[model samples]
Target: MHRDIVYASPTAGGEQRDLRLDLQIPRTKGPKPLVVYITGGGFMTANKAGNLDERTYVAEQGYAVASIEYRTTTTGSTYKDGVADVKSAIRYLRAHSAELGIDTAKVAVWGQSAGGYLAAMAGATSGTDRFEQGDNLDQSSDVQAVVDQFGVHDLAKVADDFDPETKATYMAPGSFINAYVFGPNSARTVVTDHAANRAANPATYLNRSSAPVALLHGDNDHIISPSQSLILLDALTRKRVEGTRYVVKGADHGDLPFLPDPEAGRKWTTQKVMGTITRFLDRELRS
Candidate 1:
């Protein structure tokens, strides 16, 4: 049976914002890896109940899936708040690892788009306790591996090269991310605020301690450019960090609906993405 778990106030200001998780457990007594799945909405609209259909499919694959809801730009303009919420979710799950039947040692964090960024962050910062406050050491929120699909890894770099002539038009109202992160200056400051931009970026924290990551992105994505993934892969390689990156031939950003179509290039690329993720996870978790 599926369970919906609530984690109350993992952090200081999270008292009013309890995290909701959709836990899907397979009907087996044997131990299985716990996959923490994060949904993508450009850091704006998705929640813990991400695409229920997909959750069911993933559960049928013989793994328990925990779909997480994190604080979005809608809750705050800064990126730290969202990052804080994800870290809190991990801690909450780890704290209840026994009750939830979570194989904490084999945890895999996976997500798409903004959620992908969070997954990568969770894996990379597994050993760091930046989100912990006071003296709570009972929880172990480390991630063994990461699966990032069209996730945004670099914000400062993206902003620096954002189309100068049409930056305003691109981030206008109704554009989910624009509406969520910047209400008034959604168009202007996304390109203007240097300090704010840096603080909201994920690439700023990369180091040798980061966990292994598998990246899947579309080469033709206009929103979060493929260049972002390329840069991230390059950095990971430079640091001698284990990582895998694949660029879909023609798929757009977050367009899973267009996958594996015989007429489209995504058909071939989708197969590669699946193999890469499976192999990466097997090596990271079962090794």
Candidate 2:
């Protein structure tokens, strides 16, 4: 496990913040395929070590798992900066692949909630010059595949699939989504600005050259509707990009049925839910 490795020091809000990542490498002899994991915190906070257990499991499957930290709302950064930070981290990893024992040819990004949104953007916007900023400019930030878990794809139409109560709450003026899209406490709704909404939507960037994507969403996810994944899949299909969707039944946003809970005898670990992700990564990265 390599901890607190500074991937980039990009300027955000007139201050340069050093972004770091914790990498868990497998015990295998050869350079391993990399899986970059981004955590979910409503786009406000990010912890690189937040999903260590799950990431370690992926490392055990012979892949290097890197849990990355990106600039968030609390850091005075918006989705655009967050996307750039993700790409910068990828470029940094690719630049240091030889020393890090990473297989530069094979790379994937996986994330939940807000991070998942960024992951989808990373995959959909591959080769896009705008998001590919910061250090390691010569290296490509293009990933081979993407695993988006309950992420918001279309920011403008996110409320279209939400329940009445959820829509009323999330689309409120001072909601987190507002803060995420606009500034921290700006009096602006996410869908109000058409151009900004389209810029933030991952589906808007989909093309034939975009990486294949595997979207996993819980049917019972009230925070992010399952229809969000469908929207992305639809765009992928239209663009002739390979896309797959898995709607987990009876699973909430980040609850027991979707994630593992040993105390509740929930075995939705590597053999089940995680297995689905590993299999996709195997096919996309190892094949």
On lDDT, the candidate that comes out on top is 2
Q: Tell me the TM-score of each prediction against the true structure.
A: 0.81, 0.93
lDDT (Cα, tens digit) per residue for candidate 1, span 1-287:
45557754444233465567888888788766777888877765556765565556556666678888776655543345566666666677777778877676778888887888778777766677755432225776677788888777655444333576444554444354444445433453544666655545555556666778888887766667678788778878877778888877776765343232334334324445556666776788877
Candidate 2 lDDT tens digits, 1-287: 99999999988778988999999998779899999998888887887867667778889999999999998878668898899988988889999999999897978999888889999999989867768788889999999999988888886566676767778778776676776788776777766777877878888888766899999887777667778999999999999999999887776676332335433223324367899999999999999
- Cα lDDT, all candidates: 0.66, 0.83
* Deviating ranges (above 4 Å) for candidate 1: 10-15, 133-137, 159-166, 170-190, 255-272
Instruction: Output candidate 1 Cα RMSD.
Output: 4.3
For residue 211, model 2's alpha carbon misses the true position, in angstroms, by 0.5
Ten residues in a row with the worst lDDT in model 2? Answer: 261-270
**Candidate no. 2 TM-score:** 0.93
Clashing pairs in 2: none
